[model samples]
Target: MSPTPQAVYLNGEWCTSDSACVSVFDRGYLFGDGVYEVIPAFAGRLFGLDEHMARLSRSLEALGIVPPLKHDDWLAIFERLLASTDAPDAAIYLQVTRGAPAKRDHAWPDASVRPGVMATVSPIGAIDGGARVITLPDERWGRCDIKSINLLPNTMARQQAVEQGCDEAVLVRDGLVMEGAATNLFAVVGGRLLTAPNGPRILPGITRGLLLDLVRRKRLMELDESFISIGALREADEVFLTSSTKDIWPVVEIDGEPVGAGEHAGRAGPITRLLDRHFQALKTRRSDP
Candidate 1:
């Protein structure tokens, strides 16, 4: 029941969260015509800043919306927002919408209308335990590659998982395991790593990319960027999900059934522990000079 943070950046101005508001006619409000990025910062150092910005640019370009600020402008804004928070680790949320139009129309607005930009900072919370996931139908739009503000489908799926006393929702489309509600899915099958390939059906998460890099660097296990069948996932030895906020989390249970096999059955497996150790080392390296 604690109060929400009051520091927010809206349209080139520093304002209280209560005072931050966009026009009702904004396309983002009317039709979710916007894109967003969530950048994580530890001890005020923003991780994957360039990569997140690159993805944001791609999302805006895909939607035909102009970026409101330059790269340096965004860096400055993020610095200011991070300074407003006292937490050692935090997440910065930046959003850009196609501005309000003179009238609500199905078509694009006039070229003169500037895009609406907003940002906020919140403390990053720790993941206390392994995830319990529920497999749900992937009913989102086709353009999942673009980080659009339209997340109703994801919200619904996550809510359903929570209602069932679960921590995450693994989305299955056409018998293929796509991803989680907000995280990318990965599984260990036959002593190899398997995950859905990068495509329109997935977001190409930044953390996911980093993990792939680590996997290749250490040659930890055979990695395959391919579709994992739902049947394969259910029978996998270990299951995990990754994201910017929750770097990597093991899936101990799915739909109330345990994951993995043999000695590690129903527990975080050896491979998961190894990858997590590498991830921690990566974080520590990032914090170093």
Candidate 2:
């Protein structure tokens, strides 16, 4: 073990990650009934933490789970965990789940059952160059708004992508593209940028939201929240995926065909590159203490 003061906050206590224990009867384990948020940290500082907390609170409210702690309490916990991590690039993962009940049951009405929370700071994986993608039917539940711990469909799709030598999977509902297996989808057609409107179809990714704000603030390009069909996505001039950790990914190809045309084919295009640069600049603002 390195000499860094590393530990994880579990339930109401802070302990070493190895010692952070959870009761077997926890609803998060038994029923996948929990919500989670990942707030990206650049260097040692948090980026868009308020936005993340707002999303987390919305998720908790949607699931009928009470807010385990106030805003100040959460800030204290997150900052403490980050202070223990020396990673240049890291993220704060916060999860809140319906507490372990006294007995195993599908539904528990006891208000006394407290929620279980786990918070930690971990290194963010780096992605080199562009990403290859495979599209699949969006076979997830209706309430994608809530960042619930139940991610069976997403995990399966991601695994499928891995088996096919793809970096990520874009999910399609009906005939329209909903989102990626874990990230939000953005397609550049002609010269205009388009992304799925926030709703049950996709999770309001913190990175995605920030990028949208940047685009609007900078007037970088024409953009819309209109739905994108699979055909449109396949024919788009450029495509990208955004998440809390990975930042942005320029999709060079889909299925087996190359994205874009001619010279820029199978490569990161102008708009995608522009957004990535600006987004990185935004991250730097939060870097300095």
Please tell me which predicted candidate would have the highest TM-score against the true structure.
Answer: 1
What's model 2's lDDT at 228?
94
Model 2, range 70-138, lDDT digits (tens) per residue? Answer: 999998998898888878778888899999988889986488999999988888878998989999999
| lDDT, model 2, position 22 | 92
Best by lDDT, which number? 1
TM-score of each: 0.97, 0.96
TM-score (C-alpha) between model 1 and the true structure: 0.97
In terms of TM-score, how similar is model 2 to the real structure? 0.96
Candidate 2: minimum summed lDDT over ten consecutive residues — where? Answer: 1-10
lDDT of 2: 0.90
lDDT against true structure, model 1 = 0.92
Alpha-carbon shift of residue 113 in model 1 (angstroms): 0.6
lDDT (tens digit, per residue) of candidate 1 on 1-289: 8586568889878898877778999889999999999999987899888789999999999999988999999999999989999988999999999999899998998789999999999999999889999999999999899999999999999999999999999999999999999999999999999999999999989999989999999898899999999989999999999998898899999888899877788889999999999998897788776
